[model samples]
Target: MDPSQFSSQPPEAYKSSGKSGMPAAPPPAYQHNPAGYPPSFLNQPVPQGPYTQGPYPGQPAVTVQPAVFVTAAPLANPVPDYLAYSIFTMLCCCLPLGIAALIYSIFTRDANNSGQRELAEKNSKTARTLNHVALGIGLVVIVVIIISQIVIRTAR
Candidate 1:
């Protein structure tokens, strides 16, 4: 195959890259300094492109975006405020409050394992149950006392 096929022009007209305004090689002689001077040629500034100045009119500068660090752990959400309040209310009272709390506890227990919800529900239920029992017993004792008083009064 003819080598002439490789280029647009004839081989006889070939010129060294230097003749075409391209770099030939490094300037041959380096001035050696007894003090061990750093080379000057490498320090020369490379030709800069127009874009290197800064961000373009509408475009952002070419920046390396910070990688978002994601974790295997799931994201957390805040517990609803009303649920927290209800559970608190149940604890302070003694009677029927306990019954209501028990209902809430059972209903929410599974749903609340978000840890916060479960704990609040559990406490509220406990309070309600305590109050409900206390109220029930207290009412019975009062009724018995009233009936005895009426009987004594009638005998007199």
Candidate 2:
């Protein structure tokens, strides 16, 4: 490709103006300071001595209150005692209900780990209820066995 195709006008048209077709404006009035501080800071009056309670000679004395920041309470996670009950029921009570309780207890942990607090709470309640059911069934069975033994002995 020919480089001359990029230019629509002669080189004399580019001499007076920039790429925008207008002459560039002068820079701002502020001078760049090489010492890192602003140019205005160079002319400012320095402090006479150590800062006291009173104001400067021409300035008004202004009182400022110290800031007080209060942080919010931390989030507390819920603790569900489902696993312990499930384990106890599994050992000493009905096997099927105890297994269901154990499963729900595991689900509670999983929901808690996944940050589903509501689901975790629901699972925890279910596990506890199953544990109670297993315990009730175990107790009823024990009572029936005891009553049957009493009846057999009385009949003899």
Candidate 3:
């Protein structure tokens, strides 16, 4: 291609592609007075009647009372469930009593959670008693077995 074919200015197709080179006409002057326009709702006066104030005539006056909310207070000293003691007795001490203790312990926890303070205390006491009995029985059995083994060895 000859260097003379490419002019410094853009091609005719590019120059005519966009908006016309003429400046836009100035926007119509804003009419401050809305003279020819219809009346707006803002210009109209608000309606007044008996319905605006309170209850209709002859009916009792309605009083609005503030809402009241009541929540229960948390217990100061919660009862002990004795769950660990019950489990230990069940596993190592006596099976039947230990199982009973575990059940009572679970009952105690459930009662406490359900907001039954009296029931929780009762179940807690029962579990503790059962654990004590189970542990006592286990200790007595162990002692008796050891004594018997000692006697057998001496006899031999």
Candidate 2 C-alpha lDDT tens digits along 51-149: 324554578989999999865332258548489889889989899999999999999887776667778888989999999999999999989999999
Clashing pairs in 2: none
The count of residue-pair clashes in candidate 2 stands at: 0
Q: How high is the lDDT of residue 74 in model 1? A: 19
Superposed by TM-score, candidate 1 places the C-alpha of residue 156 at a distance from the truth, in angstroms, of 1.7
Off by over 4 Å in 2: 1-75
Ranking by lDDT: 3, 2, 1
Deviation of model 2 at 56, angstroms: 66
lDDT of 3 by residue, 42-86 (tens): 454333542344544368998999999865444467689999999
Tell how far residue 141 is off in model 2, in angstroms. Answer: 0.7
Model 2: how far is 51 from its true place, Å?
Answer: 54
Report the CA-based lDDT of candidate 2 relative to the real structure: 0.77
Candidate 3 residues lying further than 4 Å off, grouped into runs, are: 1-76
Provide the clash count, candidate 3: 0
